[model samples]
Target chain A: MRTELTERFGIDYPIFGFTPSQEVAAAISRAGGMGVLGCVRFNEASELDEVLEWMHENTDGKPFGVDVVMPAKIPTEGSKVDLESMIPPEHRAFVERTLDDLGVPPLPDGNRVDAGVLGWLHSVARSHVDVAMAHARKYGQIKLIANALGSPPPDVIGVAHDNGVQVAALAGAKDHALHHVEARVDIVIAQGYEGGGHTGEVTSMVLWPELVDAVGDRAPVLAAGGVGSGRQMAAAIALGAQGVWMGTYWLTAAEYRLGATGDGPSTVQKALLAASSRDTVRRRIYSGKPARLLKTKWTDAWDAPGAPEPLPMPLQNLLVGEAHARISQADDAGVVAMPAGQIVGRLNSITPVAELIADLVSEYQESAARLGKTLD
Target chain B: MRTELTERFGIDYPIFGFTPSQEVAAAISRAGGMGVLGCVRFNEASELDEVLEWMHENTDGKPFGVDVVMPAKIPTEGSKVDLESMIPPEHRAFVERTLDDLGVPPLPDGNRVDAGVLGWLHSVARSHVDVAMAHARKYGQIKLIANALGSPPPDVIGVAHDNGVQVAALAGAKDHALHHVEARVDIVIAQGYEGGGHTGEVTSMVLWPELVDAVGDRAPVLAAGGVGSGRQMAAAIALGAQGVWMGTYWLTAAEYRLGATGDGPSTVQKALLAASSRDTVRRRIYSGKPARLLKTKWTDAWDAPGAPEPLPMPLQNLLVGEAHARISQADDAGVVAMPAGQIVGRLNSITPVAELIADLVSEYQESAARLGKTLD
Candidate 1:
């Protein structure tokens, strides 16, 4: 499982895990794979700085990374208040009607919901990158910074390179990857349509090689999407990827099971474990983008005929934030929205991060050995 | 490139090419890869028998296969006339209006178009299968019989087995693959969303592994969809596919370029070469079912508002047969409907079948070697 990615990132394996939890990220780093904390959930620079500080303190000086959502085109380009005004009234009404129809109860008394759309807009995400870079400079432990939506801006790429951190961007198509390379990013994560979050129509088998043939020599291409096992990792490498960038597989890890409060699997984690690959649907019901998520009454309601089309980015996120908060507090499995990938079919159990990494390494070795025998 | 697929089929390579032209099919077999002749175009059993006889005489004792479209559920189980009667007048008017709007000229004088919808119905397809079985029984060189839409009927599978011919079926999902295995299919071609003709939403990366995990031990799985390069073949093999079943790549082969009468590439081929991967769309314009096809005026017209939706199976195919004849005769690239996968981006040039096979072999070896180095 050791490739140029392993040596470059100073990890035992080339598998990179993306998670929002600091504990899971630290566990992944400790297990010899790079754990990248998703910074999109953090609304303030102070919160992000705190998480980075926590990660640095807990991982025993192991290297990890941070991911921020920085789409090239933001729906609105001002303060969160201005972005909220851009959301259409009909879109907001539709979201409310859907939750009302689904019988998703509101948050418990006195639990106020935040109405502001925080992470998806350009200003917020740019601030996120700035804060992450500042924390990386102070801590010297963050080795990678990944832009989730599009190519990282030139200045951000420059700052990351100047700070000795590799910059990576997720591309669902070859053209996106070529643009990323042109932007001087050090790594390209070619995420396929089967991937959990934002994706293009191209699948991993086609997207990996197309990106590899287009820009593999220029940058280390990491295959993302439907990679839940060691054999899948071997396949990604064989398809010309230097490593694998996985997120959904780590959701059910033991570290994630023990949440911020040291409790067992979250409601979302339980939903993910019970899901089959076919259970997920790519719909714009949550984030205004076609993100793959668990098929719940929330998603189904939006898909029904006469439902208003979802607003773009910041607006859509704004419209759904309160509804999402309400559903989460209610904790009803039927209406809870859980973002996942087609790889969920293989995620039928929970294990420790170290054991998951070991299983991937062993499966990869066995697959390689089998192919070698055939070659012989 | 040798695997159990090669040994079982007695071919030098495990790659199987599916094409409607006998010339391309024979050329593929002559070049060491199995070529399965697509039999949907042949309306008459006599025409199919003649082509099979031609393939037998041209392949020089090499093995080949046959492909028949036998969808598990027929839209209409009655005769061609009864099915044609089911097509509404509005559907016929819409087809006429579309051809008129596209400026597709009528066929030349003395060239009468066949009005019968032949390939999609159960009776017609079953008769085609019976003729193929008879030919296979008569000629021992045909080693495989593939069902394009679904699992071959149990009796057909039994007959093929009795005649020492293997049965293959195309599956777009894991459940479909399991059904094929349950039906005792010797080979399951797990095609992804990127595949041509009919396909499910599951992409090759997800579909290949899911199908492999479900039925790899029960039956040999052939990875299909978006497989246009040797690196892709290596990826499929690593993902647990025994071999690859390819179609769109052969459409631009030199053999296809040199048509049955030694002419140039067909209008569809020219259109295919000029198009990008994004140019193809999965629509139910030509066939009643969703199939990936070139985005042309033919498909676009049907998608326009106020246009009548296409009728089911034989009815839709029947309604459009004459319109297709007019477009092909007119040689209008903009109106020509060509079934292709997202891999159209890589088919930039035409090459002979032998060179294509050699390139694939060399590329596979190179990719395997690179992975071997990483493993060390």
Candidate 2:
């Protein structure tokens, strides 16, 4: 499959894979699509810098991208202790109670959670940009710096452009995309409500075309949300998206498990593998914004009566960081908080990233051919 | 544009337009797509039979269909009085309070809201089927009968088949479609959450392909949701839908305003035409089940804190039926409760039904060509 995105990036296909694992990102790049490594997990620029170095060596000279959590409206920057203090006591008590009820053990000695909200702060995102610019100048391997929440600030966009790197931002609504285009972002990723993580109320079927029409030629539109297969890719292209920005489908990739901290498939991956499309809920407990997540016991608890309202962005993450770490360590699939889309129904097995990309390409081809036949 | 639905009905395109107006339905059928008249508004079989007669005369010998709300599990059949009494006083008070707050006028002298829940009664749906079967046998214009809620009872499906009418049912998930296929539903419409009226939680982008895969060869899948443009039609086809089952787009048809009881465009139509895709809310107030509707003051009032929870199905309709009539008569666009999908954003102008159908055909062709070019 080819489109404006493929031509712009000189990639073979119009699929852009977003994953937290550098290995999965590199695999997607080597397999002819852009693999975007999510940088939000890194607490410090040095950690991200080391990961980018590893990506530069392992990507086989192919271009890959990095995604960072940079809110358009910058939040107050502070130390971890200061951030933790902002979280309400009631909210902390609720999290502690839920984690205890779920039987999630405390972190082992010397494993305290730190810098949980650092990536969310504007200062930390500036550091992330500094690291990305350095890699762009040194090896010319950092081709894209994508902002996960919305458009990066104008100065950040300017810095990326000056460093010869493209900028992408996620918009869940047409008006937001228009603002992104106005902000002069290089690419607009229109993430619909059915997508994993942060999203808006509109579905992909309605949002993709609306954004394409609204953005016009100002920026290329990448359709995200519930796009797991080649048929879905064709649907996105048919709706005038230049490409697909997929994240949830990559959570089950074999390489994702390899790069994960655990020895075997994590609970998140297992839950995703067994889930149907109906097994997802759009809850605000994830990041204080509406995000589609697996309908796990943990999510259910937050939605249950008497559960405290989740705080805003960085605060919500701060409140739940330790609980998340404990749940991950507990290795129970029922209560782990994993951001996934309705497309979880289609991803039933753990395939290698390359195989998954190949399947998408073929499925896209078959779908395109099928549409052509219908026209005939 | 040829697919199983188009070929089965010998229509030129695979668009199935669902509208409550006989004029709009006939116009769609005459313009090369099958227009299915929504029968839920008719409280009596005689009224529906007369409307079918009008449709038979107006459709220019083209095949048409009718949609009836035959809930899979039939609700307790009751008289309007019985249904009215079942609604609690608190729910009735909430409706009255909302109407008063919106300043909606009560019905004028000599007018009364009667049989509001009759069409929703299982007995009424059976009568609807009887009228449709009669038309199928007499005129052969009633080519398809679609059940709006899940699969029709086996006896209903058998009756339609005996009368040589094909049966279609709406499903929001793969398992629901599978049950429909097992019940021998001739067509399965995968109605996504973005669809208007009663709907399930899954969006079309994920649900269509899931239903298609599950109902493979057992029944053809017709995609129903936020399909407003030809590009959306192409997307639906690419995702394995045999055709598009559209409803919300018809609300703005010029012919609809002609049939509506108003001097000009009704308040509901005005609200729909002015709405953006983001202006819709999925709420249970429209029906007892979650249905997408225009974000109007009436719906907002119900969602507000201190508002009584909407009762289930017939009871909800009974409680709010008079309030709906008052809102309609008051001609206030801001407070009307109208079922509409996110595609309302694209339907800005009141175009003729034939012109709309023609545009969709050309758009579908263009989108298919666009996808072909991408493959190159």
TM-score of each: 0.96, 0.98
TM-scores of chain A across candidates:
0.95, 0.97
lDDT (10s digit) by residue, model 2, range A52-96: 999999988888898988887646467768777888899989998
- Model 2's number of clashes is 0
Query: Which numbered prediction scores highest in TM-score against the true structure?
Result: 2
Off by over 4 Å in 1: A110-112, A257-263, B110-112, B257-263
Off by over 4 Å in 2: A258-263, B110-112, B258-263
DockQ of each: 0.63, 0.87
**Candidate achieving the largest lDDT:** 2
Worst 10 residues of 2 chain B by lDDT: B109-118
Q: State the weakest 10-residue window (summed lDDT) of model 2 chain A.
A: A257-266
Each prediction's total of clashing residue pairs, residues at least 3 apart in sequence or on different chains, is 0, 0
